[model samples]
Target: MLWYVLVAIVAILVGVVIGFFIARRYMMNYLKQNPPINEQMLRTMMMQMGQKPSQKKINQMMAQMNKQMK
Candidate 1:
């Protein structure tokens, strides 16, 4: 009975180690296939070429647009 218990414990440990390696490999492969986007790069690019408005300026512009629309 004691030998059986030890064998079972060893099998479980081996399974857990195998699972960890498999999960790591899968995650690495997924990231390699579909890399994450860098939003900051997009933001920086737009800033270099497009209009950059501030909160107060945007508010003022909105007020002016409302008056003009009316």
Candidate 2:
């Protein structure tokens, strides 16, 4: 009846909230363990673009990327 319908709606809402948090935590852990980019990848990309990759430049780019991520 109407009570069953109400319970179903509440259960669905709770499930959605829990699922969102679970997914968010998983993504944060995954990103921490496997960043989307790395120094080597940056070097290769710079080489493709014909820009000489230097340690200082690489470090600066990494810092900027990390700052943006936060």
Candidate 3:
């Protein structure tokens, strides 16, 4: 009766929490293995924008990007 309903609600809550954590972990690993951006892509983008890309600039951009992601 009421006990069965309580169990069902708890089970649903637990499942939701577990699913959220698992999905979060998977996404974190995926991002680490394959970052959203790379030096080549950044260079290409800068060139397209009419800015000559330099190594120093690239490194700075990468640092900023990583900081934001973290």
lDDT of each: 0.68, 0.95, 0.96
RMSD of 2: 0.9
Per-candidate count of clashing residue pairs (backbone under 3 Å)? 0, 0, 0
Taking all chains together, each candidate's TM-score versus the true structure is: 0.55, 0.92, 0.94
Report the lDDT tens digits of candidate 2 across residue range 2-62. 9999999999999999999999999988987899999999999999999999999999999
By the lDDT metric, which is better: model 2 or model 3?
A: 3
lDDT for each residue of candidate 3 in 1-70, tens digit (9 for 90 to 100)? 9999999999999999999999999998899789989999999999999999999999999999989877
Check candidate 1 and list the clashing pairs: none
Which pairs of residues collide in candidate 3?
Answer: none
Error of 1 at 22 (Å): 0.4
> What is the model-wide C-alpha lDDT for candidate 2?
0.95
| Residue 53 local lDDT, model 3 | 95
In model 1, what is the error at residue 34, expressed in angstroms?
Answer: 0.7
Task: Please provide the root mean square deviation of candidate 3 (C-alpha atoms, Å).
Answer: 0.7
Candidate 3 error regions (>4 Å): none
Highest TM-score model number: 3
lDDT of 2 at 33: 85
Supply the TM-score for candidate 3: 0.94
